[model samples]
Target: MITIPREIKEFIELQGIFAVGTTGVNNIPNISPRIFFRVDENVIYWLDFFKHKSYKNIQANPWVTISVFNKDDLKGFQFRGIVNFITDEPTKLEIKESIIKKTLEKNSSEKIKKLSEKIEVQVIRFEPKVCYSLNPDEFSDMCIGSDVDSTQLFQK
Candidate 1:
């Protein structure tokens, strides 16, 4: 797994939702907005509610790319990774606490607790293999943590 740099990690944290790309048995591409996302040390996780289309797609193909950006700044990042579906009591509780406490930073413990009880959540854990710049106009898909020659980085 590739380590996500602090800049990229902060970029991800600033965004509330992400567009996740996936393809199912027919091999057609799908991009769906995903919330309830959390980034741990080396892995990222998002929630799938009610077995959505993205969940079905991942069942057939685990490969996915998560994209988030700031329109005003024209800055973005795309994370390419494989997802593993998890549905366990402990994981759900951990997700609940992390998402509500850290990512959302919500102090409405009672309200969030009630909401968490109502929703049946399926966690999609992401293990990123590579990451790249979203500014193709400027960087030409410069990879953040790749093994490409340093000279390539100098071109821009």
Candidate 2:
């Protein structure tokens, strides 16, 4: 198991999108892009629409992995954990309000209403068990000393 550093946690919180990976009951894996945010040190939340493959996969199997990275920096983190679906209307509304307040501060209620209508708005809570950080700088010495391609490290 890998521990998540504070910096990594902060990075994830700041990022807008993360890739979510899930497997079905038959062991078929599925991956999709999602907008997410951190709820706490151990938990991360995603807004899931009932129409996506991710939602179907999660219903079949709760275990999942999520990856988020800096597009320009080639540095990121991966999280593996169990997922739970939250559909309580009150909780969903609260989260939706908070997200709107933070991300769409200037938008009017009519605009917010239209935006909310398009989203099915299910919250997925992930309780992470393992986390890994990929930092190229940390392996700079090895890259310079060895003949192996350092760029390969950032491919994933």
Poorest stretch of ten by lDDT in candidate 1: 147-156
Per-model RMSD to reference = 5.6, 7.8
Global fold similarity of model 1 (TM-score): 0.79
Candidate 1, residue 23: Cα displacement in angstroms equals 0.6
lDDT at 141 for candidate 2?
32
Tens digits of per-residue lDDT for model 2, 1-156:
234556666787677678999988777888897653445555777666555677888889887888888978888777667898777888877776566555454445675446556656777778776555656556423321212243453244
Q: What TM-score does each of the candidates earn? A: 0.79, 0.70
lDDT of 1 by residue, 1-156 (tens): 777778777788877778999999998998998656788767888777657678889999898888988887888888777899776879777875677556446334565455555556787789886677887476745567643353443243
RMSD of 2: 7.8
Instruction: Give me the overall lDDT of model 2.
Output: 0.66
Clash pairs (backbone) in predicted model 2: none
Candidate 1: misplaced stretches above 4 Å? 103-117, 146-156
